[model samples]
Target: MKVDPDFLDTLRLGGEFNARQCINCGTCTALCPLGMEIMPRKLFRYALLGNKEAVLKSTEPIYSCLLCKMCEANCPGGVHIAENVRALRSYLNAEVLEV
Candidate 1:
Protein backbone atom coordinates (compact mmCIF):
# COMPACT_ATOMS: atom_id res chain seq x y z
CA MET A 1 0.00 0.00 0.00
CA LYS A 2 1.33 3.41 -0.95
CA VAL A 3 1.29 5.82 1.98
CA ASP A 4 0.56 9.49 1.60
CA PRO A 5 3.70 11.56 1.98
CA ASP A 6 1.78 14.39 3.58
CA PHE A 7 0.14 12.05 6.04
CA LEU A 8 3.49 10.48 6.86
CA ASP A 9 4.95 13.93 7.39
CA THR A 10 2.06 14.80 9.68
CA LEU A 11 2.70 11.72 11.75
CA ARG A 12 6.37 12.67 12.01
CA LEU A 13 5.57 16.24 13.02
CA GLY A 14 2.75 15.27 15.37
CA GLY A 15 5.13 13.00 17.29
CA GLU A 16 2.50 10.33 17.57
CA PHE A 17 0.49 7.94 15.46
CA ASN A 18 3.42 5.67 16.00
CA ALA A 19 2.89 3.44 13.00
CA ARG A 20 5.53 1.09 14.31
CA GLN A 21 4.17 0.43 17.77
CA CYS A 22 0.45 0.09 17.29
CA ILE A 23 -0.71 -3.45 17.98
CA ASN A 24 -4.42 -2.84 17.37
CA CYS A 25 -4.98 -3.25 21.10
CA GLY A 26 -8.01 -0.93 21.01
CA THR A 27 -6.70 0.91 24.05
CA CYS A 28 -7.06 4.29 22.35
CA THR A 29 -10.68 3.52 21.61
CA ALA A 30 -11.41 2.33 25.12
CA LEU A 31 -9.95 5.53 26.51
CA CYS A 32 -11.43 7.88 23.92
CA PRO A 33 -14.50 9.87 24.94
CA LEU A 34 -15.64 9.87 21.30
CA GLY A 35 -15.30 6.09 21.05
CA MET A 36 -18.97 5.62 21.79
CA GLU A 37 -19.66 7.46 18.58
CA ILE A 38 -16.47 7.86 16.53
CA MET A 39 -14.42 4.79 17.36
CA PRO A 40 -10.88 6.12 17.03
CA ARG A 41 -9.43 2.67 17.54
CA LYS A 42 -11.06 1.42 14.38
CA LEU A 43 -10.03 4.61 12.63
CA PHE A 44 -6.46 4.01 13.60
CA ARG A 45 -6.65 0.52 12.20
CA TYR A 46 -7.93 1.85 8.89
CA ALA A 47 -5.12 4.39 8.84
CA LEU A 48 -2.51 1.75 9.48
CA LEU A 49 -3.93 -0.15 6.59
CA GLY A 50 -3.49 2.90 4.37
CA ASN A 51 -7.20 3.19 3.67
CA LYS A 52 -7.31 6.89 2.83
CA GLU A 53 -11.02 6.88 2.11
CA ALA A 54 -11.84 5.50 5.51
CA VAL A 55 -9.45 7.93 7.16
CA LEU A 56 -10.94 10.89 5.37
CA LYS A 57 -14.49 9.76 6.08
CA SER A 58 -13.55 9.48 9.71
CA THR A 59 -12.25 13.05 9.80
CA GLU A 60 -15.43 14.37 11.41
CA PRO A 61 -14.74 12.38 14.52
CA ILE A 62 -11.16 13.47 14.43
CA TYR A 63 -12.23 17.09 14.26
CA SER A 64 -14.94 16.54 16.85
CA CYS A 65 -12.17 15.76 19.27
CA LEU A 66 -12.06 18.20 22.17
CA LEU A 67 -8.27 17.97 22.25
CA CYS A 68 -8.64 16.97 25.89
CA LYS A 69 -5.39 14.96 25.67
CA MET A 70 -6.95 12.30 27.87
CA CYS A 71 -6.55 9.59 25.23
CA GLU A 72 -2.86 10.29 24.82
CA ALA A 73 -2.34 10.33 28.56
CA ASN A 74 -3.76 6.84 28.88
CA CYS A 75 -2.20 5.34 25.75
CA PRO A 76 0.26 2.63 26.76
CA GLY A 77 2.19 3.15 23.52
CA GLY A 78 2.18 6.90 24.15
CA VAL A 79 0.35 7.81 20.94
CA HIS A 80 -0.27 11.54 20.69
CA ILE A 81 -4.00 11.44 20.13
CA ALA A 82 -4.49 15.19 19.97
CA GLU A 83 -1.59 15.83 17.63
CA ASN A 84 -2.53 13.02 15.32
CA VAL A 85 -6.11 14.22 15.29
CA ARG A 86 -4.97 17.72 14.45
CA ALA A 87 -2.83 16.43 11.62
CA LEU A 88 -5.72 14.43 10.25
CA ARG A 89 -7.93 17.50 10.53
CA SER A 90 -5.41 19.56 8.61
CA TYR A 91 -5.16 16.94 5.92
CA LEU A 92 -8.91 16.80 5.60
CA ASN A 93 -9.16 20.57 5.42
CA ALA A 94 -6.78 20.66 2.52
CA GLU A 95 -8.23 17.72 0.62
CA VAL A 96 -11.97 18.36 0.88
CA LEU A 97 -14.05 21.18 -0.55
CA GLU A 98 -15.40 23.60 2.04
CA VAL A 99 -18.88 23.42 0.55
Candidate 2:
Protein backbone atom coordinates (compact mmCIF):
# COMPACT_ATOMS: atom_id res chain seq x y z
CA MET A 1 0.00 0.00 0.00
CA LYS A 2 1.11 3.53 -0.62
CA VAL A 3 2.15 5.52 2.41
CA ASP A 4 0.91 8.93 3.39
CA PRO A 5 4.18 10.45 4.57
CA ASP A 6 2.40 13.09 6.61
CA PHE A 7 -0.17 10.76 8.15
CA LEU A 8 1.37 10.82 11.62
CA ASP A 9 1.50 14.58 11.62
CA THR A 10 -2.12 14.69 10.49
CA LEU A 11 -3.09 12.32 13.25
CA ARG A 12 -1.27 14.45 15.80
CA LEU A 13 -3.42 17.38 14.79
CA GLY A 14 -6.40 15.56 16.29
CA GLY A 15 -4.86 15.51 19.76
CA GLU A 16 -1.72 15.48 21.86
CA PHE A 17 0.02 12.14 21.95
CA ASN A 18 3.57 10.84 22.16
CA ALA A 19 3.31 7.82 19.88
CA ARG A 20 6.82 8.46 18.58
CA GLN A 21 8.17 7.48 21.99
CA CYS A 22 7.08 3.86 21.46
CA ILE A 23 9.93 1.38 21.66
CA ASN A 24 7.97 -1.53 20.11
CA CYS A 25 8.88 -3.75 23.08
CA GLY A 26 5.34 -5.22 23.00
CA THR A 27 4.85 -4.27 26.62
CA CYS A 28 1.62 -2.50 25.80
CA THR A 29 0.26 -5.45 23.83
CA ALA A 30 1.05 -7.86 26.63
CA LEU A 31 -0.48 -5.63 29.25
CA CYS A 32 -3.70 -5.20 27.36
CA PRO A 33 -6.69 -6.33 29.44
CA LEU A 34 -8.68 -7.15 26.31
CA GLY A 35 -6.06 -9.49 24.87
CA MET A 36 -6.03 -7.49 21.66
CA GLU A 37 -2.60 -7.95 20.17
CA ILE A 38 -3.21 -5.30 17.52
CA MET A 39 -4.02 -2.59 20.00
CA PRO A 40 -1.14 -0.14 20.38
CA ARG A 41 2.33 -1.17 19.37
CA LYS A 42 1.20 -2.35 15.98
CA LEU A 43 -1.02 0.66 15.44
CA PHE A 44 1.76 3.02 16.48
CA ARG A 45 4.12 1.36 14.04
CA TYR A 46 1.62 1.87 11.24
CA ALA A 47 1.14 5.49 12.19
CA LEU A 48 4.89 6.11 12.42
CA LEU A 49 5.47 4.65 8.97
CA GLY A 50 2.57 6.59 7.50
CA ASN A 51 0.66 3.41 6.72
CA LYS A 52 -2.74 4.98 6.59
CA GLU A 53 -4.36 1.86 5.11
CA ALA A 54 -3.03 -0.30 7.90
CA VAL A 55 -4.23 2.18 10.47
CA LEU A 56 -7.63 2.35 8.84
CA LYS A 57 -7.93 -1.41 8.72
CA SER A 58 -7.35 -1.46 12.45
CA THR A 59 -10.31 0.76 13.21
CA GLU A 60 -12.09 -1.92 15.17
CA PRO A 61 -9.16 -2.63 17.47
CA ILE A 62 -8.56 1.05 17.98
CA TYR A 63 -12.04 1.64 19.26
CA SER A 64 -11.96 -1.54 21.27
CA CYS A 65 -9.26 -0.25 23.60
CA LEU A 66 -10.53 0.36 27.11
CA LEU A 67 -8.14 3.27 27.64
CA CYS A 68 -7.43 2.03 31.15
CA LYS A 69 -3.77 3.12 30.94
CA MET A 70 -2.62 -0.24 32.34
CA CYS A 71 -0.31 -0.63 29.39
CA GLU A 72 1.00 2.92 29.82
CA ALA A 73 2.13 2.12 33.35
CA ASN A 74 4.43 -0.64 32.12
CA CYS A 75 5.64 0.95 28.90
CA PRO A 76 9.44 1.19 28.86
CA GLY A 77 9.23 3.88 26.21
CA GLY A 78 6.81 5.98 28.27
CA VAL A 79 4.33 6.24 25.37
CA HIS A 80 0.97 7.65 26.24
CA ILE A 81 -0.89 4.58 25.00
CA ALA A 82 -4.36 5.76 25.86
CA GLU A 83 -3.78 9.21 24.55
CA ASN A 84 -2.42 7.89 21.29
CA VAL A 85 -5.44 5.67 20.86
CA ARG A 86 -7.63 8.63 21.49
CA ALA A 87 -5.77 10.57 18.86
CA LEU A 88 -6.22 7.74 16.39
CA ARG A 89 -9.92 7.69 17.10
CA SER A 90 -10.12 11.41 16.65
CA TYR A 91 -8.23 11.16 13.38
CA LEU A 92 -10.57 8.50 12.12
CA ASN A 93 -13.61 10.46 13.10
CA ALA A 94 -12.52 13.71 11.56
CA GLU A 95 -10.49 12.56 8.56
CA VAL A 96 -11.85 9.13 7.72
CA LEU A 97 -15.34 9.07 9.13
CA GLU A 98 -15.86 12.76 8.48
CA VAL A 99 -17.90 12.98 11.64
Candidate 3:
Protein backbone atom coordinates (compact mmCIF):
# COMPACT_ATOMS: atom_id res chain seq x y z
CA MET A 1 0.00 0.00 0.00
CA LYS A 2 1.13 3.54 -0.66
CA VAL A 3 2.25 5.42 2.41
CA ASP A 4 0.84 8.79 3.28
CA PRO A 5 3.77 11.17 3.70
CA ASP A 6 1.58 13.53 5.64
CA PHE A 7 0.50 10.90 8.15
CA LEU A 8 3.36 11.46 10.51
CA ASP A 9 3.31 15.14 9.76
CA THR A 10 -0.30 15.39 10.79
CA LEU A 11 0.46 13.47 13.96
CA ARG A 12 3.39 15.70 14.77
CA LEU A 13 1.52 18.86 13.95
CA GLY A 14 -1.20 17.69 16.31
CA GLY A 15 1.51 17.87 19.01
CA GLU A 16 0.02 15.11 21.13
CA PHE A 17 1.98 11.92 20.56
CA ASN A 18 5.70 11.54 19.86
CA ALA A 19 5.89 8.48 17.62
CA ARG A 20 9.28 9.66 16.32
CA GLN A 21 10.87 9.01 19.69
CA CYS A 22 10.21 5.26 19.86
CA ILE A 23 13.30 2.98 19.85
CA ASN A 24 11.57 -0.26 18.71
CA CYS A 25 11.71 -1.67 22.16
CA GLY A 26 9.32 -4.54 22.99
CA THR A 27 8.76 -3.45 26.55
CA CYS A 28 5.49 -1.75 25.79
CA THR A 29 3.97 -4.79 24.10
CA ALA A 30 5.22 -7.16 26.75
CA LEU A 31 3.78 -5.10 29.55
CA CYS A 32 0.34 -4.93 28.03
CA PRO A 33 -2.03 -7.66 29.16
CA LEU A 34 -4.77 -6.43 26.85
CA GLY A 35 -2.39 -6.25 23.91
CA MET A 36 -1.13 -9.74 23.39
CA GLU A 37 -1.87 -9.68 19.65
CA ILE A 38 -1.51 -5.93 19.30
CA MET A 39 1.63 -4.01 20.15
CA PRO A 40 2.42 -0.33 20.47
CA ARG A 41 5.75 -0.84 18.72
CA LYS A 42 3.98 -2.05 15.61
CA LEU A 43 1.58 0.88 15.70
CA PHE A 44 4.38 3.38 16.09
CA ARG A 45 6.29 1.76 13.26
CA TYR A 46 3.26 2.13 11.02
CA ALA A 47 2.94 5.78 11.94
CA LEU A 48 6.63 6.41 11.30
CA LEU A 49 6.39 4.80 7.87
CA GLY A 50 3.27 6.78 7.11
CA ASN A 51 1.17 3.65 6.83
CA LYS A 52 -2.21 5.21 7.40
CA GLU A 53 -4.01 2.02 6.39
CA ALA A 54 -2.22 -0.06 8.96
CA VAL A 55 -2.92 2.50 11.62
CA LEU A 56 -6.55 2.69 10.70
CA LYS A 57 -6.91 -1.06 10.49
CA SER A 58 -5.53 -1.33 13.98
CA THR A 59 -8.63 0.23 15.49
CA GLU A 60 -9.17 -2.62 17.94
CA PRO A 61 -5.68 -2.29 19.36
CA ILE A 62 -5.61 1.47 19.46
CA TYR A 63 -8.84 1.91 21.32
CA SER A 64 -8.07 -1.14 23.41
CA CYS A 65 -5.15 0.65 25.04
CA LEU A 66 -5.80 1.34 28.70
CA LEU A 67 -3.44 4.30 28.90
CA CYS A 68 -2.09 2.64 32.02
CA LYS A 69 1.49 3.83 31.42
CA MET A 70 2.92 0.43 32.32
CA CYS A 71 4.74 0.45 29.06
CA GLU A 72 6.02 3.96 29.69
CA ALA A 73 7.57 2.87 32.96
CA ASN A 74 9.33 -0.05 31.31
CA CYS A 75 10.45 1.93 28.29
CA PRO A 76 14.20 2.27 28.25
CA GLY A 77 13.99 4.66 25.33
CA GLY A 78 11.76 6.87 27.42
CA VAL A 79 9.07 6.93 24.78
CA HIS A 80 5.93 8.70 25.85
CA ILE A 81 3.66 5.75 25.13
CA ALA A 82 0.70 7.03 27.10
CA GLU A 83 0.78 10.40 25.43
CA ASN A 84 1.28 8.78 22.07
CA VAL A 85 -1.73 6.51 22.58
CA ARG A 86 -3.80 9.48 23.55
CA ALA A 87 -2.70 11.30 20.45
CA LEU A 88 -3.43 8.27 18.33
CA ARG A 89 -6.88 7.94 19.89
CA SER A 90 -7.55 11.57 19.17
CA TYR A 91 -6.35 11.10 15.63
CA LEU A 92 -8.67 8.15 15.19
CA ASN A 93 -11.56 10.13 16.54
CA ALA A 94 -10.90 13.06 14.26
CA GLU A 95 -9.92 11.15 11.14
CA VAL A 96 -11.89 7.92 11.26
CA LEU A 97 -15.02 9.39 12.76
CA GLU A 98 -14.52 12.69 10.98
CA VAL A 99 -14.91 14.47 14.27
CA displacement after TM-score superposition, residue 45 of candidate 2 (Å): 0.3
Alpha-carbon runs more than 4 Å astray in model 3: none
Clashes of each: 0, 0, 0
Which one wins by lDDT: 2 or 3? 2
lDDT (Cα, tens digit) per residue for candidate 2, span 1-99: 789998878988999757777878998888898998887898889889999999999989998999999999999988888889999999999988899
Task: Quote model 1's TM-score.
Answer: 0.71
Writing each residue's lDDT as its tens digit, candidate 3 over 1-99 gives: 789999987876656767666777687888897865557999899888999999999988888888888988989888888888888888888778777
Per-residue CA lDDT of model 1 for 1-99, tens digit only, reads 456645555544434454455566777777777665455566666666676767877756877788887767877776666776776666666667442
TM-score of structure candidate 3: 0.89
lDDT of 2: 0.88
What value does the lDDT take at residue 59 in candidate 2?
83
Clashing pairs in 3: none
Error of 2 at 63 (Å): 0.6
Shift in Å, residue 74, candidate 2 = 0.7
The TM-score obtained by model 2 is 0.94
* Residue 97 C-alpha lDDT in model 1: 42
